[model samples]
Target: MANHDQVLDASGLNCPLPILRAKKALSAMESGKILRIIATDPGSVKDFDSFAKQTGNPLLESGEEGGKFFFLIQKA
Candidate 1:
C-alpha cells in the first residue's frame, strides 16, 4: 500500500547517496508531505534515522521487504 505523497527510489545507492537524494526530494516537497524512500543499502536504516533527527523530518514508517529497505519521512 502506498501511504505517502511522494516516492524516491534510491535503490542500489550507498550511504550518502540515498540520504542525499532523500534530502533533495524532501526539499522539493511541501511541509507535512511524506516522502517514501526505497533503498538497498543496509546502513540506510540508521542513516535515515539520523537524517530525520537532523533535518527535523519525522520518520513515519521504516521496514523491509524482500531485499529492499523502505522509509517514510514526513517533512516538518
Candidate 2:
C-alpha cells in the first residue's frame, strides 16, 4: 500500500457521509496524494468502490478489521 498523506475517520457515519468527507479531504490535498479512510458502514465497500471509479481516484487497498472498513485512496 502507498503511504497515506492524510487520514479521514468516517467511522459510525453511514452512506454518502464517508464518501462526502473523503471528497472534501481530497479536495484540500495535492493530486496523487493518498488518503486513508476508516468507516463503519458496511455499504462503504460499494460506496468507496464507486467513489473511486466515479472520481477516477485509485482505490489502493480496502478491507475490514475489527468491524471497521479501511480504505486507501490516491487522489486523482
Please tell me which predicted candidate would have the highest TM-score against the true structure.
1
Taking the tens digit of each residue's C-alpha lDDT, what string does model 1 give over 1-76?
5589998999999978999999999999999999999999999999999999998999999999778999999999
* TM-score between candidate 2 and the true structure: 0.94
Candidate 1's TM-score reads 0.95
Considering only N, C-alpha and C atoms within 3 Å, which residue pairs clash in candidate 1?
A: none
RMSD of each: 1.1, 1.0
Give all TM-scores, in the order shown. Answer: 0.95, 0.94
lDDT tens digits by residue: candidate 2, 1-76: 5589999999989988999999999999999899999999999999899999989999999998788999999988
Cα lDDT listed for each candidate: 0.93, 0.93
Which residue runs does candidate 2 get wrong by more than 4 Å? none
